[model samples]
Target: MNSLVLFLLTVVAFGSCLKLPSSFKKCDRKTTDFNQCLSEAIYGALRILDKPLPSHGLPSLYGVEFPDVFTMGNSTYGLLQKFYQTRYIGLSKPENINAKLDFGPLTITLTIEATYSQLTVETEFEAQGTIVLLPVNVITPVVYTLVNPTYTFTFVLEEYEKGTTYFRVIDSKIDAQTQGLKFDYKGLFSNKVLNEEFNNAMDEKWRQIWILFKSFDEVLFAPLFGTIFNDFLKKVPAAELVDG
Candidate 1:
């Protein structure tokens, strides 16, 4: 009788230890890897922001000084310049990109080092300190929009994967308000002869910007984001992959 009781006790103990689902185990491991990959990728890409803007045929609409205010054909184009200079543009180049991942309590922090050039009137924007990850659900899809007068961009990610994933953007314009300007340019900068040229121009500008943003969806963020996600997956244990 005592032997039987001992056997039953051992069985109960083992069963209790096996209470967790296999999938849960796999997900826990995958989640850790995913967080690490995200940190690495963000750090690397943010590093690019530090580098000098490549001379990508972006004409240097030369003038006495950075225009206090200017119009692009019919669309007004000053707010973005002001915003870029004040918020996005950097004074120096980034020296390093650092990232940390917290698996116990999922979170990621990124830090960047930078420097500026005083001579060329050019600035290099770096990732500076760190960007933290609030709570995120890895399984669900997430959408982010980067909006500007020139473009209305959208980014969608289904799951963080290394290669097989999609990201896209769309450009659009706000209504009626074109920062007060007029012209008749088409294609790259549309200047159609609609009933309300000003309104139409503004709409067209927004539409064109969205289109441009969409075009860059695949080219700009895919490879960069993918590589980072992939690296993270690799860190996951084999046992976890099977269970997940």
Candidate 2:
């Protein structure tokens, strides 16, 4: 899920009570070049995540945590994957990026496209049943990589009035592309040969496996990010974050 790291951009706005860090740039909506400025502002903010901004409700990018346990099963792959206690590293390293913000009559939409050459996710996992006829049963440290993966995310915002106008996420879409995928499980089938073979197959059939779980992004990630972003937006009115 290389695109998983990109969600930080969607949650960039902070509460009005918290001052924007000097290093953070603001792109006023009234500016003629606001679209490009917004993109640069977002790309620049990625570098600031090396440390947490507690007052601003932002966490460090080096180790963003996903604590809740979640499960997803696919009949096509015959695999049930469960994950919990997951943490991600290397989020601040997005490359070849393009972020665009569009303000419509009734919505503000943000679309971000970026490629991650290397993003690491460490998680405790349990896989029951087989994938593509391969037997598997594992509950161990799982480290996965999606080589040179590019992600696109679109967020639709709706304005509401609470004394002042504020924007909240009403819908979102997540998309990703990758050259290949690799998984390194510490103890799969309890045999070194079997583990290597399984990984080799994964590398070869990465796209198919990725597609098999594409629904997970829509079912889980989109809503999860929308909720987090909306929480932050709740405290910051639209007029405060961007000039109208």
Each model's Cα RMSD = 20.8, 9.3
Worst 10 residues of 2 by lDDT: 9-18
Looking at candidate 1, what is the lDDT of residue 5? 87
Give the alpha carbon lDDT tens digit for every residue of 39-107 in model 1.
Answer: 345334444434422221111111102222211221122111110121122222223223332222322
Stretches of candidate 2 off by over 4 Å are 1-16, 72-80, 129-137
TM-score of each: 0.23, 0.80
lDDT of each: 0.29, 0.73
Per-model tally of clashing residue pairs: 14, 0
lDDT of 2 at 23: 86
